[model samples]
Target: MDELSVKCLLHANDQVILVPSACGLQEMVNKMNDFVKKKSVKVYVGKTKVMVFERGESTTECDLIIENEKVEQVKEFIYLCSRLQIIANMAEISKKRMNADNKVNGA
Candidate 1:
């Protein structure tokens, strides 16, 4: 989805959470409750690091940098990047969980 849609969704959903990518959300999963999950999205423009993270399944963090871009444009980019990360992370976790479940069942 686009940035505005993503932001709207985040504001609307109580289950979604956001955290800054610099906060090391990946290393803090154990402290999270069972209802929460980890999500991360990274943006690289020829090696620059621009990343966003959603942690604890209830927050949405927006970190949009405006260098050559306008304020509104940067805001959208930030929202989109963060939302993408959340989706990607969720998919990854789901896949891993499925694989683990399969292994246990097949074993």
Candidate 2:
């Protein structure tokens, strides 16, 4: 739909595509086809990754394709090194706490 909005974030050689809905994503992909051809930029299909973030029990999966290349789906891909480190530290703390609790309970 033309009314739908899509956002593209460019950082270095990477690009982040965001859409409000699945239809918006389709619209963005359609526009990107024209954009790729017009810009004459080589499509790096192998390097492309897609991450779909949704809430609750819905099991619907969104597939992102650009220039006829299907992008790989990732469970988690952190853009910020600091954020990733924080997640890692949190996991370590949780593990240590669980171990201490188990020892105390003699489990």
Candidate 3:
């Protein structure tokens, strides 16, 4: 997936942004900042963080730094109401789902 879409969904008083990183993290952030500037919206930097999804790669070199603080990387994230992993693995997701179901059923 190219993931080259500008997502801007407004809900009540909050908005969501889903920027694709076809280039790199820094480039994506720059692109997002440029986009925000064009739209004349202020980005709440304190509330913003980066979630990197990659497999079999060292992320030590990836510095998703905004301002002076480095954005934290998360393994799993909840978007909307569903739990989504950054890396796409159908089997893993299915297994995790089954485990959750079993735990619930067992209880």
- Residue 98, model 2: lDDT of 96
- Model 3: residues with Cα > 4 Å off, grouped in runs: 1-23, 56-61, 86-95, 104-107
Could you estimate the TM-score for every candidate? 0.23, 0.63, 0.53
lDDT of 3 by residue, 15-104 (tens): 555655425556667666777778887666666645555664425344576655676655655555666565466776799889999999
The CA lDDT of each predicted structure is 0.38, 0.68, 0.61
Which residue runs does candidate 2 get wrong by more than 4 Å? Answer: 80-107
Q: List the residue pairs that clash in candidate 2.
A: none
Better of 2 and 3 by TM-score: 2
State, as a TM-score between 0 and 1, how close model 2 is to the true structure: 0.63
Best by lDDT: 2
lDDT of 1 by residue, 11-57 (tens): 42222334434344333322332223334332222332233434545
What tens-digit string does per-residue lDDT give for candidate 2 at 2-88?
787778878776777777777777567767767777888776878776766565433557777877677777655666442221223
Model 1 clash pairs? 16-58, 16-59, 17-58, 17-59, 17-60, 18-59, 18-60, 18-61
Say what the RMSD of model 2 is: 6.8
By the lDDT metric, which is better: model 1 or model 2? 2
The TM-score measured for candidate 1 stands at: 0.23
Regions of model 1 farther than 4 Å from truth: 1-49, 70-95, 101-107
Error of 2 at 85 (Å): 13
